[model samples]
Target: MNLWPTYRCAGIKVVHIADDWSSATVRLKLGPLNRTIFGTAFGGSLSAMTDPFFTLLALKQLGRGYIVWDKAAEIEFVSPGRGTLTSTMTLPPEEVARIRAATSTGEKFLKWYATSIVDAEGRPVAKVRRQIYVRRKRGSC
Candidate 1:
């Protein structure tokens, strides 16, 4: 679901969508709205980079009869992101299947996933863990 434009509208840029899964790389050009007091990228902006991908991918591959939401989250800032930050997200087929199987009974389940934010040199600047909560639709397959 085209979240890139929405991100860009707020000054974050969607760099690329990997051919594998719905994992995408999104970057933001620091501006008044997103700049920190010292003029570096704001923590909130950096944190927001991990927002949409994993759960979106889960929803798409998981198909109907399920709802996905961010359940738990942790972000470790390894360094202050100055410029050109990139975040990558991916999900494997088996993981998708597991989540699906676990929630097939209309019971809610939480799944853990991760994403890494790297600098232009490909060194990790931050690691984000996303816990996705899923629940099945009533009387639906």
Candidate 2:
């Protein structure tokens, strides 16, 4: 995608983006580009993989009436984060429906979600938490 190099997240390639509105996963690989001096994936890159999913998923499933944001985030470094890291993001049908029901009344609230950062071999390297604000825009929709 055009955004891979624009934001310097080239190593953070999006491997799977399904049209059914169910899932997405950002892939990481070991190479000279995104590596640190210790030969590990950069922590910032790991964190960056998580940014847009929450908002994009919400918009895709909930339609145009609501606003979603990456309100807050925290990460736990569980390993050396060597070789590579992959972050998988998913939004279940029930949760998406819940958001629509809660915000349909035109009120705003802060919501939170979390994901795990895993190595190439599927070991968890870190845990990430994200907060999003949901609301309806005035006079817009």
Candidate 3:
């Protein structure tokens, strides 16, 4: 999403998305647009960096028959982020299987996923949790 206006303006970049759509790595660089006055990563930027990946992976993996939406989120700032920070989001196979089974009857399922945004040294800058809603499409069952 590097070229997407919101991400681009905030210096957020999608570093990689796995071929199987199971995971993704996103980066936020400390730059003019995303840094706080004290020269650390902006809290909003840190939070924004983690906004969509988990649901994105879920949607891609679930493909055509399901609807996935990022239902909720929370972010805890662990430390000041200088330089670059990265967050990698993954949806495990078992979780996907569980989602499939849970939603097979057209019932909605809510799943929470966590990811740590870390600085260049691998120290945590923020801890983020995202809850996604998944359901089978009405006519797809």
RMSD of each: 2.3, 1.9, 0.9
Q: Whole-model lDDT for model 3 versus the true structure? A: 0.89
- Where is the poorest 10-residue window by lDDT in model 3? 44-53
Top TM-score prediction, candidate number: 3
User: Candidate 1: misplaced stretches above 4 Å?
Assistant: 1-6, 18-20
Best by lDDT: 3
How many residue pairs clash in each candidate at the backbone level? 0, 0, 0
What is candidate 3's lDDT per residue for 5-42, written digit by digit as tens?
98988889999988988888999988998888899998
Local accuracy of candidate 1 as per-residue lDDT tens digits, 12-130: 77677755465677876666777778877777777788787788778877777788898888888897776678887887778888887888887898877888888778878788999
Q: Which residue ranges in model 3 land beyond 4 Å of their true spot?
A: none
Cα TM-score per model: 0.85, 0.88, 0.96
Clash list (residue pairs), candidate 2? none
Candidate 2 residues lying further than 4 Å off, grouped into runs, are 6-10
Write one digit per residue (lDDT tens) for candidate 2, span 1-141.
426573355477777777866677877676777778998877787787887787777777776767777788888888878776788788877888888777777887677788998887788988988887878766645
lDDT of each: 0.77, 0.77, 0.89
Error of 2 at 38 (Å): 1.3
Residue 123 shift from truth in candidate 2, angstroms = 1.2
